[model samples]
Target chain A: MGVNTEPDVLPEARVIAVAGLGLIGGSLARRLAECGRRVIAWNHRPAPYEQARAAGIECVDDVTDLARAVPDVLVLCTPLKAMPDVLAKLAPVLDSRTVLTDVGSVKGQVRDEVKAAGLNDLYVGAHPMAGNEFSGYAASDPSLYDDALWAVTFDECTSYDRLLVVIDMICEGVGDRIIAIDDDTHDQAAALISHMPHVVSTALANELAETPSRNIAQALAAGCWRDMTRVALTDPDRTRAMVEEDAANVAQLLHHMSDRLESMATLLESGDDEALAQVRDFFAVARPYREYKARERGGAAHESVTVRIGGDEASWRDQLLASAKRGEHIMHMTDRTHAIAEIRTALV
Target chain B: MGVNTEPDVLPEARVIAVAGLGLIGGSLARRLAECGRRVIAWNHRPAPYEQARAAGIECVDDVTDLARAVPDVLVLCTPLKAMPDVLAKLAPVLDSRTVLTDVGSVKGQVRDEVKAAGLNDLYVGAHPMAGNEFSGYAASDPSLYDDALWAVTFDECTSYDRLLVVIDMICEGVGDRIIAIDDDTHDQAAALISHMPHVVSTALANELAETPSRNIAQALAAGCWRDMTRVALTDPDRTRAMVEEDAANVAQLLHHMSDRLESMATLLESGDDEALAQVRDFFAVARPYREYKARERGGAAHESVTVRIGGDEASWRDQLLASAKRGEHIMHMTDRTHAIAEIRTALV
Candidate 1:
């Protein structure tokens, strides 16, 4: 076989290694430490080390020190672009006992980097659905992860035991919900929700920037415009990088979005009886989404269910993926055989 | 002449008439009453009459009675589609002493309706930039008008005296800011800021509804997605009506937006160094807006200025429009010849 998947046993995670103490990394390390996990953290810059140690997190000078410590779980909280270099550094010192994972926004490329670094056997993937517009260690807060949901991703060569350890870190340690799926699914879903929308928001702000009567238009702007363009105000370099990293998926979604807007323009420009009827239909197609939001706003509690994973080792992944597709979030693992989940975001 | 421009010495508005007790109308009537004006109101259904009267507003049986009272200003608070019928009802009874204005979202259409109803001479269009997701008198809030800016639109035959009376209602009676401009400019600015952005937001929601992995995608959604899609969850019928009212402007903007998104997709799909550079440029185009928003977040005081209106009656309108184009909100009128404005939304 081209890859190894021999390992099948990992102990419950009590110690976690966090690499790179940025906003996401710093918050996660602080949270894990607060959960009573021995969080060992390293930052490229030692600026946050003192504060991190004061939070009861152990500080390390080099990332290799994290690998040498051989914690139950090692989370690479470094930015996506920093993945390869950090992965390369950890490849030699990282013990097989440590299950590797990351909190990168994009999963497919991060997985490719892990494979390239010859650390695929130990790597699982994670992305916590938490953040504000703010960034850096100074903006990091343990409460950022409050009631957060995460996507735990895998691939063909992914170790089940490693996946279990990552799930332990997320569900038991971080006190969050998760959906286990493959890397490609994670990337595409992320593009649809986050990456592609960032491009659209930027396009909007760019259009306003080019408008001759921008100031007058902006004066008339209300909550709608503010909410729509809020993401565009984030660091452009960072947004560009995120969009570029998920290039193909974002491009595909953009094309779909472009077509949607073009067709709408045509319908509006026509301004005939039939076109007007079509425009109404254009708004109608989103009725399901609108209704879903209505229910969400109604504060209806999501119904909880138990999912029993069955079939072969391969089919267990499929079963969980299918459950996620049905809008279920695995809240906790009861055992190797079953997981408890909540139906959180289903649309009719 | 097609329209009349007579009566140059209209009195300050101490008496106000409000038609329709829906969200916008009810909120406005309550606010005017609280400001200690003699507020008379009419609604098609008297459902809100009890509550409105309790709030110190005078309830009327018919809209014509509002006109018969000869209030200093008669503010039509009905929805745009109801404008024609309401205007037709008030046309014969509306006293010449009453300056006419409507709080419609679209100005061009309302002006046309007023002209058709033979009430153009009495009309001075006004639209308050205030509302919430909820509707009806139940959700009517006096604080809705708190620090609100209004667009007071004019036309070729718009009476200068009538404009001053309407300005009195908005400034002194309602305690708000105003920007006096022509109908088409007001319509276009509203389209640029509100109507067109509503279409874009709905399109985003529609796109998400159609995505195969929608639930999975939505699971990954956080603040950016939530804020961007919030407006789409509002009543689609209302959104559709607003978009249709400004079809031409909204269509043109959608085309520009579509092109922007498509070009970014092409640059991303190319995935070369030059293409990447272009992608960076795409994000960079919005830097001015970013900096503007940053400065706004810093909460620096907006520099205030006094604009002197001169060069004949026609040129007075031009002077105020020019001030508005420079991102000024006319806070209070110092005199007929001078207005005090704040530099609130300048882009560069």
Candidate 2:
């Protein structure tokens, strides 16, 4: 994850084509337009085009015509399913100097789609981890990206100059916490956390529906139940598509989560106090990590780099072998007890 | 379950001995003191008694003075297991007219213990469904009980004259939404809604603790995760006690929940869109129940009789069954809805 190394501020793009005028597209357009960039908005349906135009935004109905405008940047804000076709529509008219990116949930497939559409040289897969329960232009807010993660998925063939430019744009919308993650890692990790949790919450709420005791359940559910099931109220078809499209990775995560739950159930059933104690200890250990993330929201924490490893035996061994690989080199490092340990190498 | 019946408000008692000066006890004492009743605070530990005394409240460290003080009401405000021993201590010198009630989470066990102690005629089982994440006397706020359910568990052979007094006391401490329920239904319903969800949330938080990608998971977790897992930080011993004592009922609920989740997983694995749509519809149907409950949280909403059922049957069935049964018929009439093809009957 790229957090350190001074931010590369690129000059503003002259003309930007946003391929979908929904939540992401509208928000991005509003922000960029406010910052004095000419944003050309496009939507499949004609409804959003008017809204975009009414807001003093440039609107284009045809992808080819929009592409023919030869904007300095092309931001594909369409849904995952529509991304490939959108790319294909613009591929023939694309300029080599134009930088391309998207605001999709999953990065792996988008990366593949970019390659298959022969736009690898132009496109940099950017997944801004920002959204609301609501979708569409009316619901969009420019501040939606204010202090959120914008994961710029990168591979060896990705243009470093274009990646930096996209990063600069993302940082402008959100804060300067631009993460550089491999496409696979970002997608798989997202599947484990965001995608799977949504499905679980929806399932729980769905199960309680039409049940005899649902009224009492509703009465008893405090802040906890509300938070746990809020995601259930979001559009199911959109979430379903994301999960099904990344079925294999999502399935793996589901299996892992299920196993964890099963173990917990076993401990509860057997009255295993020791196991329960261990679980409690785990929560205590994880508390700092959770608090760290909570605090990291709305602001950048540090200028430090995070190293990523693939999901393999080498990854496990690397975790053990890589001492302070988290951007910190040698120097006085604090141990678990908060005592400083002297190291020979220079610190990052 | 008791619904719309007029609560027999008891006359103000001369002296009330609160047998646990913790959050609920402290809050109750403050309310009673405010209502011009002299409350004798007793705590097994001396610290809270001192804290209570500092607030201009009378405190007692000894249990033997129950006979000497001869309070009209003896409130057992300890945990469920402690109730029996406290009752036994109070029994030796208890007055015949002395009414006893408890502030325990689980009602069925407390009812059984009160019966076994031969205090059935004098004992009333009460559960004020209100709380905060924090505990102890310092954390107590009298208004915490404002507009909350004060469920009074009763059965055959209970003195009607004494029941009114208990109901009035609860109404004064909390708002007058006094619900009369049987011990079995209270326990079972509570297991379904309160206890089971707490267990589920805690288990989920614990599951996430062990993941190598917990940092990523935590970062990706938005308002939904924070809201959902708020209950995961519950005091471990209290959680253990709840599940352990009510293991049978809680286990059944867990089984039901597990089955639901497993079925959902199966549906996802099979890629069944029709089943998924049905699941979504179920959640939509269940939305009104939660909304109604949310509406009733504050205001004159509490003045109306709210008859809530513990099972999955529609709201109409709950009303019909409550009306059809003898225990339910005696309750007062308030707001109403109709069940399918059910014969309409007036509340007695």
Overall lDDT per candidate, in order of appearance? 0.87, 0.62
* Tens digit per residue, CA lDDT, model 2, A1-348: 111224333334567778888998898888778777677878888787766776667987687777777776789998887887888888888877678888887887888899999999787787776777778998988888776666666675775556655655665433434445567666766766667666667656655564554544444455656667777665566666776667656666556555555554556667667966754553464454444445445454454333332223334224312322232211111221111211211112
For model 2, the superposed segments whose C-alpha errors exceed 4 Å read: A1-15, A35-38, A44-58, A109-121, A155-161, A172-175, A235-246, A272-348, B1-15, B45-58, B80-85, B112-121, B155-162, B172-174, B272-348
**Among all candidates shown, the one with the greatest TM-score:** 1
Return the TM-score for each candidate structure.
Answer: 0.93, 0.77
The sequence of per-residue lDDT tens digits that candidate 2 reaches over residues B126-233 is: 777777877888898878777566666666655544554566566543333445555666677677666766676665665556555454455455666666566665
Evaluated at residue A273, the lDDT of candidate 2 is 73
iRMSD (1 decimal) for each model: 0.9, 6.2
Candidate 1 clash pair list: none
A341: Cα error in model 1, Å: 1.8
Compute the interface RMSD for candidate 2.
Answer: 6.2
- Worst 10-residue lDDT window for candidate 2 chain A reads A336-345
